[model samples]
Target: MSCSGCSNAVNRVLQKKEGVTSVDIDLEKQSVLVKTDDAVSYDDVLATIAKTGKKVNGGQVIA
Candidate 1:
């Protein structure tokens, strides 16, 4: 996710997914941080990656 290509790929696909408020690519941590409203569904996230021809390695939120 930190690679420019990965970031660009995610951005290109996420831009089309609804309710995507922002995306942050952290090269140092090698992670893609995505933020969105409650309207955004998990399937939409998966679909976005699918559209981008990339796979979501894994993700989870912690309180």
Candidate 2:
């Protein structure tokens, strides 16, 4: 994200998700780290991010 407001916007939206446990946004790296339960799918996360009107350049599942 470009600024703290952008990060906060993303953080707020992701934090509202049902299975989201935590959210870490790395402004320097322009990336977001989200921790979620098994019920949360990769697509679900992506869609949630999209809800913030941010263009997701890419994403990957750690496990």
Leading candidate by lDDT: 2
Candidate 1 stretches with Cα past 4 Å from truth are none
Global fold similarity of model 2 (TM-score):
0.95
Candidate 1 — what's its lDDT?
Answer: 0.75
Mark the regions of model 2 whose C-alpha exceeds 4 Å error after superposition.
Answer: none
On TM-score, the leading prediction is 2
Full-model lDDT for every candidate: 0.75, 0.94
**Candidate 1 lDDT tens digits, 1-63:** 657887788787787777988887776777777777888877777778777677677887532
Q: Please, what's the RMSD in Å of model 1?
A: 2.2
Model 1: worst 10 consecutive residues (lDDT sum): 54-63
